[model samples]
Target chain A: MTSFNAALVRADTPQLTRVINGYPITYLDSGATSLPPRAVIEAMSRHYELHHANVHRSVFQTASEATEAYEGARLAIAKFINAPGGAEEIVFTKNCTESFNLLARSWGRVNLKQGDVVLLSEMEHHANIVPWFQLRDMLGFEVRFIPVTDDFRLDLSNIDELMKGVKLLSVTGMSNVLGTINPIKELSAIAHKHGALIAVDAAQSVAHSVTDVKDLDVDFMCFSAHKMLGPTGIGIFWTRKEILRDMPPFLGGGGMIADVSVDGYTPANGPTRFEAGTPPIAEAAGLGAAVTYLTGLGMANIAQHEHDLTGDALTRLELEFSGRIRVIGPRDMTNRGGVISIDVDGVHPHDVAQMLDQFGVCVRPGHHCAKPLMKRFGLNATARISYGPYSLVRDTDMLLEALHSAIGMFG
Target chain B: MAGLEDLYKEIIMDHYRSPRNRGELPTPPAVCTEGFNPLCGDQITVYIDVTDGVLKDIKITGQGCSISQSSSSLMSAAVKGKSLEQVQETIGTFKQLMTGHETALEDGGEPEKVDIRALGELAALQGVVKFPVRIKCAVLAWNTLSQALSELPS
Candidate 1:
């Protein structure tokens, strides 16, 4: 096993040095949003200070520079994801939620009809489920979900029936709450076997591990930059260029037109067709820097480091707290990322999180935008803590101490 | 730490541990109204039986955290057997207490002490103002009580 230099990674992240409540901040909520490194911040600031102009519209030097940075970020993301269709497939959106909306509105609206079905999983984030529900109201398509098994994996027992008549299967590559990494390749194979196009919500997965869209054979993939140590206002929506050419534009205004007349407007070709209005120029630069930084550290090494930390925490928590706290995700390192959801007996997650806050251990306590999944497990909420490249075992040690105090108070 | 102590006062924790008037009452004579904290998934249903402008019985049933459930438990006990006017006054005082705007009004129209004696045990929740995130948790039951009251007649 390759060892990781977590202290070196932490040195790059300025937020890791912050102290709260007289204790060094133990940021365990990276599953919710990763703290950006100084390099990402500097890159964004450089773009804004040196080259600040709207993309694809103006004829000046800064405009060309802005456009170059924007499109260059798309190329960076393409290489990061190993996107088979390359930079032409990348469309910038407000966030991952908007990217899902683009799929539901543009591709889904065009392909799906009244009798068609869009199969999703129980572990999908609300962003993946809600858009299809909204489209269902308009297009009259049926939406079905694959259930989760008791072992904290997607229950595919009835997948054959679930996939019958399904035109599209949209799922999360990794659960934001559970940290269960879904087998996208296997799921995509099944979806294709049933003549359905597969789309992956990579919001949680892309940051933690390597994501090769071509290898997974997913037709569409979307993720947010903020979750991946980048700026908040940017996300990437990648699809096959041929499919994007046929799909209608989701949002319309300037910068997405070929020719406009009193009669109508012809939409632009390729990724720019869906990207209307002024995009997040500085955010794109930040994302470009983020991918560069992640590549420098190496995605596989980051995953291995996180897995070791997560695996250690899991063992320590169960051994120390046994029968007192239950983990909501998988117990082992196999087929999982660093996201850990803990259910402390006889205490509400909010109260538990509040107690942890005193010790400067930041953890998210809520449904985590996956309400239906919460209902599946008879839980309203759980305390979710995840890892990024910079997260350390010492952070998890602080987290355990906090959890012990919280349990002593409430349990 | 002071904020945490003030938030989890013995009275509040006692109410949470052994809630008062926790279940539903017989209805038709009783009218129930529900309110939910959408963000945290705290749903509270207040059941009130008003006979001739007096609350005959008050009960609250819900699933929520300590603050919300305890607030509801304490409120149900406080509002029971009180007149409609007294219930309204308590709700107003509680809201003002949470917001820290105008605490209480003396008969002379001066912004003075709240006469915490009037609030009885519900005054234990006065420390909620310090914890901004918990104000709503402390007020979910009061909002439902207000809704339940408006459903009653003159």
Candidate 2:
């Protein structure tokens, strides 16, 4: 048994109370998004009830309060990720997809040219892959993929050769489908050795592990609030202050500009240069509370908690299902998270997900926005069950119960 | 609150388990068109061999859930021996059945009830509308079939 009491954490999540289809909701889709705790909801509601106003502009008291709430969230997020450049390095976007788009459009266009190469992995979600491909089409830069090994690890054996002519190495810190925890610290060193900048998509790993940007030494990192017990509509794009200062602003609008006229305008300094229009102020308040909640839980404890759950679940799944089920990710617990994608013999993933839904067990069934990886494995889709800090062993027990029924039904 | 039985009717499951006309035909003689539900990565390739305005043969080759695969099987069985005009009528009625109330609402009138009797065995898939997300899975092969018919050498 793990030291961390996930049932206690689950009690604070209001969504856990709901009963679906005559059964309690067994939410196992945290890889897609996490459920916000009561603290996050209350903080958001409090912002709307007491201090609701537009941020950064008005001289009035409420506006300042709103600005403080918004900026305070940035500070909390910066501290959460241990960003060396502090809040100045954090640029808010719509979500992790927008963050990657900002990185590709702003930094990519300026730095990369015809002969340059961008190295991405086959395991990357479409969010990380599509933006660079979109940029590569316009910039005429070559894009290469680091192949995935048969055992579901990044084939870094040819890393040195693949890194040649690669100006940027972009990869996910943890695969949403496979739950493979990448070696970001080592990859960062390899990228630097090849004179290429590295970007880590921490969208999946941010909530499950401790992400210190300083220790990783990654040039860029991106994550979303919704996947980390926070509200939707807000995400973070973090880079060093030096790189952020040099890169041009992505979206052109009122808040992003330093000075404007009929002629071309100069962009503002710091993170605000990229944040145009009204930002997600209410969402930011929720995110701030979420950060505080996660900090209180202690990230190390959450990591260990998930690690224990994953090990137990993997062992049970193999023992119970045997030949009927095949895990699509690494069997070993080392460098793995709580994501478990499985392919049931003779049953489609969608069908499995549909049956699980009958038991009120929420699991995602699809390619998981990682079609390249799916193609690599010769699979159309997989039924993926992921975990959050609130997830418990009983959840996996319910999952096993549901899977037994699903397979029996299909049979 | 429709149960799993409603979505996966006995006849539908039978068709899914042992799909009819499950392989592909030669491309030169049989025109092939593909449809994809990108959301779930469900793909279908529809091949049809039409002669003298009659669909002599219809085959389905794809990978998807029961809803999609079974719907294709049902569709192939229904249209394989029909004239082009009859096949077009069946397609119209099936699409109407799938659309349910949306078509009637668009015309600003009473909810035009789908006549299930007219749909024959295809009516077994009517429960798919209760779950909106699965509707795409049911219609993917039909869309590809329609595309193939439209592109037929006229």
User: Which consecutive 10 residues in model 2 chain A have the weakest lDDT in total?
Assistant: A1-10
**TM-score on alpha carbons, each prediction:** 0.95, 0.97
For the predicted complex of model 1, DockQ is 0.46
Query: DockQ for each candidate?
Result: 0.46, 0.87
| Tens-place lDDT digits, model 1, residues A186-237 | 9999999999999999999999898899899999999999999999999889
Please report, in order, the local distance difference test score of every candidate based on alpha carbons. Answer: 0.89, 0.94
Give model 2's docking category.
high
Candidate 1 backbone clash number: 0
Residue-by-residue lDDT tens digits, candidate 2, A310-359: 99999999999999999999998999998999999989999999999999
Q: Which residue pairs in candidate 1 collide? A: none
Clashes of each: 0, 0
Model 2 clash number: 0
Best by TM-score: 2
